[model samples]
Target chain A: MTTKMKIKTGNSGGYDVLVLAKHPMETGNRKDQKTGEMIPAHFIQTMVFSVNGTPVAQAHLNQGISANPLVGINISNAKPGDTVSVSWTDNKGESDSAETTIS
Target chain B: MKRRTFIKGSMASAALAVAAGAGLLKPTRVLAADWPEAALSADQVDAAMQAAFGSGDVTDSGDVQIKAPLQAENGAVVPIQVTTSVKADKIAIISEKNPIPMVTVLDAGDGAGGLYSIRIKMGETSPVHCVVSSGGKLLRATQEIKVTVGGCGG
Candidate 1:
């Protein structure tokens, strides 16, 4: 349930933070290939982004998001060595977080 | 005195349980309580707009931009970027033709003002809508994307 996140310094004098999370994002309408049983909905419901322990942005997502969801935002005034973190929780009550230092 | 104290203790614990049950105890994480279920599950675009943005009229604005290919090769993963000249407190993506019209909503706090990028699924060719909530006004922009393959599972 871990997410792959990256932070890049943008040309406009801000940091571009991106998070790519791995999940099936099933819409509960998909059927299994072998069993023909419908797969229940399993997608990340919320994602929270923080900088240096302060919450910055939050995203409300659903099954409409692509599998291995990727989201990005530009954070201003972030200095080198600052920690930017992202955490996500899914419909199945599973959650994981990742952090990266601004370089 | 003992009976009164016992009664007070039970009531306090009951309140706490109710709050926790509503998923309001976690301050750090955006819990299910904050998720807009009605809007996301709304089948039609107009219904979804009502659920998400209430009855307020959303005017089309030239300041908002939706950057995506006019033709998407893969409906499973279509990259979309949104930028706005207005101060964006929140940004919402809606696909007109999907089973569920509302895709996702981003609460752009002070740090992330007007730039957001994400990947979404599109069932077919449809007009992707971007609605930005700035101040008390709802500004919107739409772009039609032609998808070769359907994204939603069959």
Candidate 2:
């Protein structure tokens, strides 16, 4: 998944950063494109959002969670334009991460 | 290696058998093998929940709160929210009836002020279990939401 993130002041609410990923999070159950066998269930298991080595939000996910879900967080005493980092691990052990400085 | 003729013949037979049985290809959808056991039986549901979070000692300490439909119109996708009275180190949310009992577990980094909100799909009538871990101990609570029936909340 692409690692770049988008940060901006909340249009009408207080949001530090908005994270988007490029992968389809295909619950492995989807039939493979070349191979017809059912793909195993693979999805994001945990996500950690941080700023300057401090944590902001951490969510443990499950299969029932919709693919490509959006997380809106209300930060504590954090203002606009803070450097934020994100880390995620999927069930298949495909771990990848990225960071974005809030605008 | 010289058994090519016999191997090819068996391969062709196997292909024909597969093609003939193509109608039986009702592909398996997730079967959700990991769904928590609470979804199966009422007794197991209660037991699993209790095992995760003790029930009686749980007093209405503003420490924990749950948000969901008092009466969900659709069972397929019910949105629930859980917030704590105090900032927590970890938060967990689970659906009793889901193929798996533990739906979510999150470690509230030092940044977490003990507040968490997430939307989860409920496949049927069930209890939403909310547990918070702190000081090496677990605190838990549960609220039952009645789903009207579409997919999850029902």
- Identify the leading candidate in terms of TM-score: 1
Candidate 1 local Cα displacement, residue B20, angstroms: 23
Give lDDT: candidate 2, residue B25. Answer: 43
Error of 1 at B21 (Å): 20
Predicted candidate 1 versus true structure: per-residue lDDT over B73-136, tens digit per residue? 9999999999887878888999888898899988878868567899999999999999999888
What TM-score against the true fold does each predicted structure earn? 0.85, 0.62
Q: For all candidates, what are the clash counts?
A: 0, 20
Interface RMSD of each: 3.8, 6.5
Off by over 4 Å in 2: A1-39, A53-57, A72-74, A77-80, A93-103, B1-60, B150-154
Clashing pairs for predicted structure model 1, backbone only: none
Question: How big is the positional error of residue B4 in model 2, measured in Å on the Cα after superposition?
Answer: 4.3
**Candidate 2, after superposition: displacement of residue A99 in Å?**
4.5
The most accurate candidate by lDDT is: 1
lDDT of candidate 2 over A48-78, digit per residue (tens): 7888758766665655664554443445545
lDDT of 2 at B112: 52
